[model samples]
Target chain A: MNEREVIETLKMIQEEKLDIRTITMGISLRDCADESAKKSCGRIRDKIRRVAGRLAAVGDEIEESYGVPIINRRIAVTPISLVAESSRTDDYLPFALALEDAARDADVNFIGGFSALVHKGMTGGDRKLIDSIPRALAGTDRVCASVNVATTRAGINMDAVSLMGKTIREIAEATKDRGSVGCARLVVFANAPEDNPFMAGAFHGVGEAEAVINVGISGPGVIKSALEKIRGSDLETVAETIKRTSFKITRVGQLVAREAARRLGVPFGIVDVSLAPTPAVGDSVAFILEEMGLESCGAPGSTAALMLLNDAVKKGGLMASSFVGGLSGAFIPVSEDLGMIEAASRGSLSIEKLEAMTAVCSVGLDMIAIPGDTTADTIAAIIADEAAIGVANNKTTAVRVIPVVGRKAGDVVEFGGLLGRAPVIPVSRFASSDFIGRGGRIPAPLQSYRN
Target chain B: MKAIITVVGKDKVGIIAAVSAELAGCGVNILDISQTIMQDNFTMMMSVDLSGSSVSLKELKARLNGIGERMGLVINMYNEELFNSMHRV
Candidate 1:
């Protein structure tokens, strides 16, 4: 390219506000597990601190060098449930506290992986961990938690799902003065991916190497701008515009991941090309999907609409980056997407339809609001069902469910800012403990094969 | 002296470990390495200290080129000055 072309390209990146969304360091905490919970917790804290100490500093240096903003520097560790398995009754609280301290020492905004796998049924340890979620989240400022309760292979664990529903309700009541917002940091899942870098969903997948770095990029503005330029254009043109826009966005992500991996001296992990939406207006992935001609975010043909959007995004992103992974699709987190919120407010969307849409996207039942009196076992069943979807399809999935205390359907609970607000969506009153009580690992699927 | 090593062409297993091992044999201290795969094409950059090498620049390039030929790779080398001018903003 000529000098003028080079100058113009630089200006485009600078002026367009294109920035790297996150640089997440994945730490393996398998080494932290010990027979005693206190010893295990201590090792986990030390491991996180030592391995992640220079993460923010290194990320900032690269951000300055590249002239791109690396918006967040974070860490995802091996699920704490695995590490905290040895906790005695007296040890669980301190173990959670140790995790909080680790995040502070590492200077990371959030430390994910306070999670458990209970798709089929809860083990004794899993039950204890599930029960401790409210205390763990309330006591810790930056530690995030998730639980998987469903998968296709084993079906949803109604028992665990029921438990989570009640747990969410309790946490909401416990933190009602804080807008009943304690569930903001918790996620439930079906088909949870092993290498997600985003949170309330990220955990060091069991398949990950000892340590690595994964990156997720967002470009809702880029896609929206592309759509805006071609106003009144036909659906094909809109789809084509989104495709081309996603291509450019993914190229930037590829460059950022390569440079970050080089600077950090770690292996380059996947680039999740998910069009993650925030609370801000004009940046919702669902809005872009809606612009492609859905009257509302969730309506008849919504799942098909979502499938097309998700497929086109992967097609464009795959062309731009060879290392694409980590739930590379559109996220339909209701509250975070302004268009979805508006649709829900107007009664164009509902909880049942959202569950149906989860069959195609990266998450299930995310940022949903239910009543305060919902039973714990019902929530557990929901998680179990979502896990079944993920396990069945061999795809990553998650749930960010919120139960608003004292808020019924049609009532809105505001979380403010990027966390957004949600209208209480009704849930089924029935419980599912009998199936959930059948405890065992769902056998690996028939199609599980690397060769 | 500092030097830059560039590798390009098709990607295959063991590319990174093999090249780094060859550099290690020369006692070359590697400062950094960046690698990416675009489609079937592989590209890499390695900054290394060339001091104390028994081989001359031409010979080192020839040896690296030979390794590349054996593995269907392309190899190139640049002086420290040129490398810095190209990369340093």
Candidate 2:
């Protein structure tokens, strides 16, 4: 190599500190189906435990040798409801418990696929599992659940949508002290995909093999730093640069994940090129918007910034790896992103603005810390709002908000590390309990009318 | 033949300048180049045509490989068809 080129590559490597985000093993539990819920749950748990026993250690060893940090080691099993067809009495809680046990045994932080793919028509098992979501989440600590109520192909499922609204309310009521802490583990999706590796939404698609290792990479700070360099550059140049930067970041993730999967003797799954931002000062999607010339994250140009970032991230990441899936775009979590928190605290960003941003990005109203006394009905209203966006747009969107207990406006809670910290932003003082308390579900979006 | 050459490795300075200089020396026309500098990593994709160049694809690949080895880089070369197909999706 030429001396000049060698030096340039070395400098980038030295300064960038790129690493892999998560090595998620997607395992299909389709074969674990049985007429008996207990037997099926036992088999499903055993299969996961046996197959993923060595996943974490292998990933760690590869990380040590390759000098790439594999931050999270997780598993995404088949949708639990698909195997609960035989449970006439609704035994989804036990299944969830079993999956949580498996996650503990595997020593992983989270395991996805406690889900139901009922975007078209609800099977008996799907209906049963949906009814049990509140119990499943409240009874278990680490179990996450997702329900796909709409899709571009089959249209939206109003029955499922209405059910989820009630399910969310039940989840809140079950964990009222934590402001619907159980709801934090649930996601309602539209156009939901099978290969997403992110939490509360990840699942093994039907087309996947027995098992494979996928990675989700995130670094909003990296993109924000690059944008800072080309402050005066033209819009087109800015777009091109964002794409190029995303390519490089995604390449690092691809390489690290490929090496990790290879070391573990598993097939490489995907690289979720999501720009997951943290609440750290410089590492935020909101920061990227500000660097792009926005006064605040929810300013007038927020949606445009999100659109450009999402497109560029996909264009660049697609070129870096073929196995790319999940919500491969910028994340706009208010509480998790330092800049967004500041914006919210300053009254610049609002729930309405954040929902608008979700039309472009993946996660909706993420890590948002609301007032401790926010009513369950209000939280349901928020979920319905985000779900409407997802349904209309035919995209996968999730809400992972924390209603900090006893925390009022201006109060800040420190989650520390990747979960980050956020200031408790005030919601509307008026209670939406009357609207949310109405037990009936909102009708499906107009887009869901396809036969 | 026209081809797209992708060089991926630890991010270091001068990789682009050196790669571009090499293409210029060979009388090759560089159509477009995109580069991103990430934390501790550098990735680049360059499109070049060698219709009038003296070196064959094999020789060009060998030279690039040598350069990559010396710089701790991984170099991959693909013809137009392969390049377009890999990114069609």
lDDT of 1 by residue, A1-451 (tens): 1223232234334444455678888999988878778788889888888888888888887664445567788888887777777656533666678878988887887788888887777777788777888888877777888887766666666566667766677777777777667788888777667788887778898889888888888867667666778988876776677777677677767777877778777888889887888777666877776776778878787888787777777887888787888778888888888888888888878877887788887777788877766666666667666666676777766767777777788888888866798877777867666655664445645555533
Cα shift from native, residue A183, model 2 (Å): 3.1
Question: Could you give the DockQ of candidate 2?
Answer: 0.03
lDDT agreement of model 2 with the native: 0.75
For each candidate, what is the lDDT? 0.75, 0.75
Candidate 2, residue A304: Cα displacement in angstroms equals 1.1
Q: Local error of candidate 2 at A294, Å?
A: 1.7
Q: Relative to the unseen true structure, what is the Cα RMSD of model 2?
A: 9.2
DockQ of prediction 1: 0.02
Interface C-alpha RMSD after superposing true interface residues, each candidate, one decimal: 11.4, 11.4
TM-score of chain B taken alone, every candidate: 0.87, 0.86
Docking class of 1: incorrect
